[model samples]
Target: MRVLLIGEYNRSHFFLKEGLQELGHEVTVIGLNDGFKKVAVDISLDQNYTSGIKKKIKVLLHKLFNIDLHSKSIKKQILKNQSQLKGYDIVQFINESSFLCTPKIECEIFDLIKSWNNKVFLLSCGTDYISIKYAYDKIPKYSLLTPYFEGKGSKNNYQAPLKYLQEDFKKLHKHIYKNIAGVIASDLDYHLPLKNHPKYLGLAPNPVKILPPNPIKEIKGKIIIFHGINLYNYYKKGNDIFEKALEILQKKHKNNISIITVKNIPYNEYIKSFDAAHILLDQVYSYDQGFNALEAMAKGKVVFTGAETEWLSLHNLKEDTVAINAIPDPQQIAKKLEWLILNPDKIIAISNKAQEHVIKNHNYIKSAHKYIDLWNSAN
Candidate 1:
């Protein structure tokens, strides 16, 4: 079978494609190639920074129009590859999300597929349309809103007050979720909310190909914290609170803890830094699991993040596996670290469990097989 994956060839993309091939299928990926070990057909979506005096104007135009101005160009590229697309058995969108921070245009290619009677599977690898809807509706009056999805119910941008806008947004969510085919959720919290619907097929968080167990070295005193920011976008990766916690930690444990901030490293060398750290911190507000947490787990490191009820119920975890629960109070965080310092045995025990969790449930081979099963079923 020939499969076409639409998304940037990142770590997750390569692993998925690799998994598919291991199952004896031919997989070809589209988008900016990161030069990973995957069969890639390079096609630039022409996504770039628009500058000049009109930077604000271009951003405003894109935000207000809610349609990617480059959609036409991307459409042309897709048309040029139409012949190749026909040769494939399935066309799967890895993220399929056109809108990252702005409103995304509905791919004209989906309509083209309608003409060919071809099947397409959209991957739940990007922004949650539902969460975006919730956030959009919660905006105060005179606030800007941009809807990313398409059709009559689609919302991209609007300037409306909180009360009126929320009512409008809530009404739209029920309809869109009901009409969509399915969603793959890595976070159990994300999955459970959509379970009332029939098409919600559960896919685990991004899988990591586990490395051989490295001998545990004494890393209790060494701690590294990761942080990032986007001025135009809301920060999800929990750098702010972590900073606050760090401030409190510094005053208390002055020279005892070492903090490191990692920003925009290349994918291949991304995991290399984890070798030096004992614990990884994840997003604070998000009850969802992200790529960083999963990769750290694969490396047998303890990852700490928020524990939502939905996730606890899904995994039946009394305490987080390899992840210490994130608490707002600096005292709480300090206490956990203190416990780690005093009890290496406990940390080792949890690390063993964490490694087992990733190996058994989130390995690339297992996740890849599940993805192939879904693709076969979808066809």
Candidate 2:
């Protein structure tokens, strides 16, 4: 089998491609840079697909209009590359969306390829417009109405308003769901909205290749906490709440513990940072696993997640071995950290349990084997 994976070659794609090749399948990765200028991994560039005057115009239109208009060009490219896709038994995709937030970008490509009668797998790596509506009950004005979202009207009011946005999102979901052959969740919570949808096929947590750091001598110092932030963007992954919590911890603890932000690290070095830290701060309010949290847990570091009771039940993680639940309150977070610092032995035991659990449940090689089985049975 030969598989072409579209999207950036991050930890997820790197691991998935390696696993597929190990199983005697040929895998070709065509990815754009995910901001890291120099990646240690060798990745191929599909300039014919992403570049050219037509695509440049479409990309500019996507930025301004929040719409995709390159389906005709992509359709031509697929027909040109039809032999590479048709000769292969399966073609797998990871993270189908372009950063411009248009569903039509990848949907058009899938439509072209699906017509060839070859097996296609779509890994819905993140939430789309419809999925966001089901989770948050509203789609931000900017996604649908770009001019209104960016201009003074966005600050004052919306022209089409909430009702119109809801209707538009629903229509998009109905159309795109019909084109996909399968939908794989990045986490258990990601699978729920599609469970009853006819396009639903299979699901798995985001996969990682590197195993957890081996047990090492505990660093002797104040407890170290890592919080990732991008000061430029203020949106839902809630960096503001994280900043507020840090402020409270600094004022109350007063030089007792060290807090660090691990942003802009090279992808390879990012994994090592977890092994050095005592605790990793996960997302705010979201109950599902993010890629960072899963990697941290695999390293045997204690993770503070928004693992509310509802989230736990939805994902079937009742008794968490590696991750600890943290409410949005800073006082609660500070108190939890204080308790862990005072009891070193308990932390060690939990860290060990986390390592064991990750290896058993989320190893990439093991997960990729399941993917192979799905492809074999797909046709």
Candidate 3:
């Protein structure tokens, strides 16, 4: 099989491509820089519009003429590479707005892909029309929108997600669904929203490249807690909640723990930034681990992320054994951290379990086989 993965989130498609290649399937990934994360792709779509006078011009044009210069550059890149993007047995989009373009432009890109590919599919791994609508209607008990509902973000900061609620995006959603083979969710957050839909494929857990186990050594003195932040997603990822929890924990146990916080770095650097960490504070609002959390867990770090009832039930695992379920409450997060600080042994045990769990369930090749089964079955 030949597969083309359009766009990426935390190098998700890159790893997926590697797994597929090992299984004797040809795969390619086309993706952007993902801003500061600088996620790699097989074919680069980055247009160097992120910084410098170009960015200022981009902003000015948008403000004055309703023109999106950056997006326009992206559209040009896509067209120039359209030939390289086609002729795949299967084509999968990483999101509804795979190109991060205006909705109308996405339709144009979709039409091009639709005409060229055998079976085009969608991946519900990020903010999209259906998922946003589902959360907007309060379908889940709590979601990334929890902060939004509590009125936390400014409109300009939320334009990416909030735009999914607009009519243009709705039409783009319909346009894709009307023609695509099916859609798959990378985790429970997206899976729940897509469940029972006619075009919905089952959830495929995010794949992680299992890391080599560290030699057994007892965690020393002050516990190291690593927190990485992406400013754009601060509110949605509940970074504010995590920050507040850190403040409380620091105030109470200043001498017991050390905190390292890095902001908006490249993907590789961000991963390396937390190497000494015994505990990784991942997102607060999620129903399953994001790519970062899973990778951290694979490295035998106890990760504070989504391991909720649905996730627990799906895996038939108990709470806090693999990863901590981080809710929206700062006080609750502080309490969880306090317990971990007190019980270093428990952290070690959970750390071991977390790595084992990811190896068994989320190994890239293991996940690739699952994707193969689903795609072939659909055919």
Candidate 4:
């Protein structure tokens, strides 16, 4: 089978491509570098002219005349690449608004792709109108929108959810959901909201390349806990909570624990810097783990991330023995950190379980087969 996976989220399509190829299927991916993460793709759609003076001018034009120069550029790029995008056995969009442009432009691109292939699946890997609406309306406790509901909506992270609630995004979401072959969730966060849809497919774990188990490093001195922060998503990812907890933990066990926080670094450098850390602090707002947490877990690192009951139930896991379930409470997070600091033996044990879990559940080959089954069934 030949598959065309469109858009990139944390190098997901890249890993899926690798797995599909290994399973004797041809796959091609087209996506942007996705900012500093620098995810690889076969056909790069990154707009080089959207920065500096050009960006300022574009913003001004959009403000004054309602002209979206960025969307115009993306539309042109899609038209130019239309020929190469066709003839695939299946095409999977990363989200409803996969092209990162206006909804109208996304519909245009989707119409073109749909005309070429009928088996197009939408992956619920990130925020979308349906999921955002569900989150805001249902207001699930300790979700990504928890901060927004709890009177901490000063950050820009809520902007996307707000925009998704608008009419234009609603139209796009309805159009795509109604026309697509099916929708699949990459985790419990997306799956829970999408599971009842008529065209909903089953959940597929995010694909991660399994690395050889690294020898457990002895905690000779201070334990190293690493947290990478993206300034734009700081509040959304609950970095402030993590930092506050870190400060408390540091004050209590200054000599025993060493906390390293890096802000807004490139993906390569970010991964390299955290390679030797004893534990990685990932997001606290999510109900399911994101790509960063899974990658860190794949490296045999004890990751403090979302392992909520919903996720546990989805995976049929009986206990919270894998990753630590991080909530929005700083005191609870500090307690987890303090416990890890005191019980060094448990860190090694959890690290081993983390790697084993990733290998068994999220390996690229196994995930690729799941995708194959979904696509075939949809067809």
Candidate 5:
């Protein structure tokens, strides 16, 4: 199969492409480098003018003259590569607005891709119209948008969800839904909301390129705990909760735990810096583990991330079996951290389980087969 995957999120498509290649399928990916994470792609469409003084100038031009130079450049890039995007057995979009282009341009790109290959699937891998709507209407208690709606989160935090609520985004969502063959959820966070949709397929676990467990070293003193923060989406990732919990844990176990917090670092440096850590604190606002948590798990780290009951049921795993389920409550998170710090033996057990879980459930090759099966069945 010749597959084309548009856009990237946390290296999801990169790993998926590796999986597909392993199964004797040809896959091409077109995406941005995804900020400092620098996700790999076959044909990169990353814009050079979206940072520093250039970004400020673009914003000023848009605000003063009502002109979007960024969108124009993105459209031009797409047009330049349109020929290479043709004639795929299947073309999957990473999200509804895959290329980060204007809605009209995205519609044009989707139409063109559909004309070339009718078998197109949309992967519900991140925030989207249906998921945000579901969060607003159904699961407002702890959804990413919940804090924003309740006036607890910054207005900037609501921008993406607000965009989804707009008519233009709604129209684009409808158009893509009507034309795509089906939609596949990458994990329980998306799956729970999309499971009942008319065009819903099934869950395909995020592909993680498993690595051998890093050898555990004897801890002489403080147990190192690492947390990487993306300032822009801090609240949505529940970093605020993690921050407060970390503070409490520090005060309580001042001599036993060494907490490290790094912000906005490059992907290579970020991974390398955390290699010697005993635990990793990942997102808390999700019901399922994301790519970061999975990557940490693959490295045999005891990741404090989403392992909610729904996720446990979906994967048929027991509570706290692999990764720890991080709740939104600071007190709960602190208690969990304190317990882990006190019981070093438990960390080793969970670390082993974490690697085993990734190998069994998120193996890239196995996930590729699932994707192939889904595409075939849809056809």
Candidate 6:
């Protein structure tokens, strides 16, 4: 199979590309570096409108004409690479807005891709029309939208996901579902909302490249807790909740625990920055681990993120055995942190289980085959 993954999400497509290559499939990934994380791609769709005079004009254009220079620049990049993008056996979009364009533009690009590709699929991995509507409707017990529902849905912080609610984006959503051969979710957060759709192909757990478990670093001196925040997603990802919990822990266990916090760093630096940490505080409002959280778990760090009932049932695991289920309460999170601080043995046990969990459920090769099976079935 010659497969083309159309976007990058936390290196999800790159890892999948590696696995497909291992399986003797020719795969190409074409997308941005996923913002500041700078994940690699075979073809770059970078828009150089970020700083200096270009940025000022971008803002001025938007203010005067409601025009997004990003949308225009990305479309031009697609045209420049249109030749390389043709003739794939399978072409999968990483999200509904794969090119991060307006709905009309996305539809145009969809038409272009469909004209050249044999089959097109959609991966409901990031915030999209269906998942956001489902979450805003309160379908899940809790989701990334929980904070938004609680009066924190600021236009500035949540503009990306909120745009899905508009009529233009709604039209784009329908057009995608009508054209794509099938849609597959990367994890349970996305899976639950699309479970009953006729074209839904079930969940393929997010693929993480599983390497030999790094020897569990001995917790020397004080327990290190790492929290990396992206300001744009701080509210949407429930980072505020994590920060509040950390505050309580810092004061309560000041002598026994050391806290490290960072904001909006590159992906390479963000991942490497947590190497010495004993525990990683991931987001508080997900039904499953996001890409960063899963990567942290694969590194054998006890992650404080979603290991909810749905996830536990899916994997048939006990609570707090693999990763701690982080609820949206500071007191509760602090309690969980206190327990881990007092029980270093529990942290080690969970760390070991975390690595094992990723090995069994999220190995890149296994995940790639899962995608291949679904693609074949759809065909």
Whole-model Cα lDDT of every candidate shown, in order: 0.55, 0.59, 0.88, 0.85, 0.85, 0.89
Tens digits of lDDT, candidate 4, 1-379: 8899999988788899999999898888988767777768898886745689989988898899988888888878877988888888889999887777888888888888888875889999888987888888865775778777777747476886667788998999899888888988998888888867888888889999888977355678889999999887878899989999998998999999877889988777887888879889999988888899999999988898989888887677755468899888899999988888889988888888888899999999999999888877774
The prediction achieving the highest lDDT against the true structure is 6
Tens-digit per-residue lDDT, 264-354, candidate 5: 8877777777888889999987888999889888888889888888878877889887989998899999998888888888888888888
The candidate with the higher lDDT, 1 or 2, is: 2
Q: Write the per-residue lDDT of candidate 2 for residues 95-205, one digit (tens) a residue.
A: 445322234545565565566646666676654543454454423211222333334233324322233245544554555555555666666545655567655666665
Question: After best superposition, candidate 5 residue 267: deviation in angstroms?
Answer: 2.1
Model 3, range 1-379, lDDT digits (tens) per residue? 8899998999788888889998999898998857678888889887665789988988898899989876778778888998888899999999999888888888888888778889898999899988888888998888878788898978766788889999989999999999888899999999998889999878887888777876225887899999999998999888999999999999999999999999888999999999999999999888899999999998889999999999999999999889999999999999999999999998999988988889999999999998887777674
Better of 4 and 5 by TM-score: 4
Segments in model 3 whose C-alpha atoms lie over 4 Å from true places:
63-65
For residues 42-120, write the lDDT of model 6, one tens digit per residue.
9988877888999899999989999989888888888888899999999999998987777888888888888988999
Better of 1 and 5 by lDDT: 5
TM-score winner between candidates 1 and 6: 6
Model 1 global lDDT (CA atoms, 0 to 1): 0.55
Candidate 1 on 1-379: residue-level lDDT in tens?
7777667534666676777788888877666443222223444444343466445655676689854444555566667877655666666655434322212223345546434434566665544455344445543211123212112122222222122234434443343334334556545534544455465666656666678865344555545444432212223334555666667767766666666666555555556665666666665554545666777767777767655555566567766455677654456665776576456666667677777777877777788788766655641
TM-scores for every predicted model: 0.75, 0.75, 0.96, 0.97, 0.96, 0.97
Task: Give the per-residue Cα lDDT of candidate 2 at 114.
Answer: 61
Candidate 1 TM-score, true structure as reference = 0.75
What local lDDT does model 5 show for residue 111? 88
Using lDDT as the measure, name the better of candidate 1 and candidate 4: 4
Model 1 residue 185 lDDT score: 57
Clashes in model 3: which pairs?
none
Kindly indicate the candidate among 2 and 3 with the higher lDDT: 3
Give the C-alpha miss distance for residue 51 in model 5, angstroms: 3.1
Ranked by lDDT, the better of candidates 4 and 6 is: 6
Q: Which stretches of candidate 2 lie over 4 Å from their true place?
A: 36-86, 96-105, 115-117, 138-173, 216-219, 231-234, 264-266, 310-320, 375-379
